[model samples]
Target chain A: MNTKIENKLTPVRIIAFIFVALWLVIAMFPFIWTLWGSFKVQADFFSKADWSNAIFGFHTEKQTGGFFTMDGYYGSWIEEEFWRAVINTSIVVFFTVLISLTFGTLGGYALARSTYRYAFWILMAGLIFRAMPHMTLISGYLQPFFAWNVWGILPTTIIVLVAINQPFTLWMLHSFFLNIPKDLDESAMCDGCNRFQAFRYVIIPIMWPGVITTGLFSFLLAYNDFTVTSMLLSDENETMIPAIASFLGTVQEEGKVMYAVAAVVSATAPLFFFVLFFQRQIVSGLTAGAVKG
Target chain B: MKHSTFLLFSLPSLSVMFLFIAIPIVSVFIQSLHIEHKQVIIVTENCDPFGCETTTAVDTEASAKLKEKAPLGKFNGFKTYSNRMHFAFDEVGEAWKSSDSFTVFTKKLYNYPLYRALSFTLTYTFVVTPFVLFLGFLVAVGVNNLPKMFKGPTIFASLLPMIVTPLVGSLILFWMVDGDGVIGATLQKIFNDNSLSLKASPVLTWIMLMVYGIWHLMPFSFIVFYAGLQTVPQETIEAATIDGASKFQRIRHVVIPHLMPLAIFITLILLMDNFRVFEPIIGFRAEAHATSISWLIWNHLRESAYPLYNAAGATSMVTIFGVAILLLPVLIRTWRDFKEKNKG
Candidate 1:
């Protein structure tokens, strides 16, 4: 891909390399540092005497008779029951992704195929709905949910998350469906299949690539969400993010800041692997709107 | 597709959006017009040895019954919208009358909860959007110049800041900038000021939050711009070079105009996201110095004694209005584009 004008070691090339290298350090260093420090005692991680102690683990060694310790992990996972939150997160994320995709695929397909004005209006309305903050909607749901006796449960949260997720899900999947040929579905209908039958027999199989890409985003939204889950779910049903936040409150006062550190690192691990595996899908999904628009 | 077919296909998704999103906004408006039920007070008269005395006390059971009967509380019209915690019309009027200058008056106005949150939210939205665009463009250019072998790893690392949960990302930064943490400690040592702490200063806290915002948002913009760069057309670049144009001139005249549409898309998303900047404030514990509209609603709902549904509803309605105003320009632009496309 390189041409003669772009290949030379010019001043601009050097600057670009240096700038990217600096940004990489800024982006990745915090996670690496936190991951490393999670194993150390609070005294060492927040070393009063020397910053070098954090890297060397002097205080950790003195406290636990080793260079590394699992005290933070133990305290958060076992003593504090962070595993309950982990299980709760798994349930919420799984159901939210499943339901959002189910609803989004149907709606996105119809919007993509229809040439009607109302279809355009629906898409526009979805765009506006997408921009509403989660907290505002939660404020509305509180009184109603409380009155209905459906508040503070996993099912209610999953449904709300699925609804919040619908707008973006529809938009992304709509663009993806638009990229598919209309002839594929039309031909199936021509063969005496009904609309649903065509979508089931013809469109469903080929739609997996788009569905998978859209599902990755749906999964991320459900997993990374803090606002809806935090406010809607009861304390017993708290997910990982809110669990970590609550850790900050009680752990800090009890001089167990390392528990919060370990929890943060634990929460970040899945996302790290998420980017590693689904990097391509995430990139494509992010650019889908831009490219189409 | 026929109208019947479309309706059958889209009903489930549309129904949920209508029920949860559309209805809730209307509900938020309705709730904002009402305030919570006041406690039921009863007076008891007793004759003591010395004198007759009367005492007033709140009847908890009656209050509970009242709340249960009407969960929406008493209708108070638009009073909640103008209260001190919201638009604060009375407070603003007082400040306007007392102060001789605009800056002085604004300083007085900033003391109100709504104004303080609004100023920070607007400042953050305006400041962070542009910086994310500019820096994201630079990073995209830089990454584009890298060797093919290094691109994937560089992109992966860049995605980390953006991909992680916002609260977790901010907390990681918050810990580092704590008084005893590495960055914070090193700064103190370098400045020879042991008392220096990032969390203690309002200005530094705002800057820190903005830096966190940029860090968390820039990667999305970078990825979009990088994709746009891939389609910049090699023929055009070669033509610009052959025509004796410098790299900067070619980029200014050709490449930038190519990416303009993507820039608009990123800016719209960034503004919407930044306007709801709630998690970072909570993560960084920066509420003492700064707040946002979303955070104001959250604070009201998370009140110590009981959830102030009315107060939260009022703030939420204001926030919805803010979002509507912010999206109006883009909505108008999109409508115009749709019309022109149809005509052509």
Candidate 2:
């Protein structure tokens, strides 16, 4: 009771609350501003005599007809055909996650169950893979991809992303499998199920939580990746990240900064809702790596 | 499980890893030792006119056929790695011999693409890693002490920065720091300087990036540490309190030691991530003032007409070596942990 009382009014507690409140503001403020600013003209947001012109929609007459405008969204999505990039992003992300998870689960399960010395070495290799910057491997891909005429295609990029994500996906899922009791699978095998049968019929249902958590990470990687996509993809196959990046390069000269801003907001909106919906899974997935390590 | 089953299960991942990760690394190293084929030019002189003249021309047709025959380019045997854009060995030596002072020599060193990137990458990695850890730890403690009702929303808010796409997040911050944007204008107004721009200068850009690094990564550290905090023994805390230790003393002695492993885990991840820092630089369009190794590779690859694959390959090798060196401590720790676990 005395400790509980002390916790209520201690200077440390008060200071912590104040600091966290400030941090919360700093963390959430930029996205909110960007979201609102995306609905306005460049002049209103970035060229007015005062910054409040952004909030009040002052001097935005040419870009918008009213207090709120969808011109940026219209310009980005329709005029510039950002929808193609969106479709490309969605397709790549879907395939990358599917392929990565398929391989990651099998590999992770094998690594977790096997006692072979080779498995240890393989896991070590995965660690090295994790540490390697993707750009290094991309350099190798450029030549072979060009030679094979597979460069700048979605399938090639998807496969490469899956390979790149495998090390991390394997590591995370491996740890997740380790937490599951080995006996669960062993008993299934005792019941005359083969290893594959045991994995399919017995262990899989229980593994969904871990799989879903790992899947969230894979999705994030496939979705949020800019470096891999930008380098591997071409103009026809631009993903949203690279497409928006191209906007940043071209929009300034063309006076369409608002399109880039709108696209940024559009790209971020999914992630915003993603966090809101999947916060628990994300937190578990995130902490799972550190805790296991 | 049968050995065959294990092998079959792991084969797909193993194959992909080999095809992409392992083999590409080997290929990148090999590719770094080569350069594009250049046509041999012939010089001819004509003395039929009032004055003699000379003409030099590249034999393009022969060069094109040669390129098709050997598309990997001619092997230069590490010459590409030492060229001006890479290690710049010759230039560095000249600068060292000719420069009057250490500062001048250092300036000349930074003029080389490799060292310029190396300096900034190292500084960003070292500086951002510690600050992320510190801020994350602070936020974790703060949120841990908060009431349950506030914790969920606070965490949700904090996670936004980390969860959003890196390029998009950096762009959001970029807009805010634009010269006429809200935060930038407000800053100027407060400082009484209309011309001051955070995006215009190098030092300020680095600071903003560092701030972004902290903000973006803090939630990760906070989440991990908060989880670590929950598992800290309540009995130890009670014991410390009953022994009349002050709050700071108790925290320093008990809480920190308890969270040390998580701290180290966060540090390892941060170091690796920060070393490959590319997206923010791109999103910020900061190539003028700050360029990372990854950015250098991007620049080389983006040359549409004459993509410098050789230069990129060399830079990739250097970046890989840098990552290896930075990861040495963590690798040692991992090995030690594995040995101890095996022994136990």
- Evaluate all candidate structures by whole-model CA lDDT and list the values in order: 0.93, 0.89
Show the lowest summed lDDT stretch of 10 residues, model 2 chain B: B40-49
Report i-RMS for every model: 1.1, 1.4
Query: For candidate 2, lDDT tens digit of each residue in B1-344?
Result: 56899899999999999999999998888888889898867788977759999998998888888889888789999898989999999999999999999999999998988898888888889999898888888888888777777789998999999988989999999888888778788898899898899878899988888888888888899899988999999999999999998988878999999999899889889988899888998888788788899989888888557888889999999998888888788778778887898899
lDDT of 2 by residue, A1-293 (tens): 86576458677888889989999999999988888888878888785278887888876655556887888899999999999999999999999999999999999999999987688889888988898877778888988888889989999999999999999999999999999999999998999998999999987889999988999999999999988899889998999999999998788654498899999999999999999999999988888898878
**Interface DockQ per candidate:** 0.81, 0.74
Error of 2 at B89 (Å): 1.8
Count clashing residue pairs per candidate: 0, 0
lDDT of 1 by residue, A55-147 (tens): 999989998999999999999999999999999999999999999999999999999999999999999999999999999998999888988
* Cα error, candidate 1, residue B11 (Å): 1.1
Clashing pairs in 1: none
Extract clashing residue pairs from model 2: none
Model 1, span B100-138: residue lDDT tens:
999999999889999999999999999999999999999
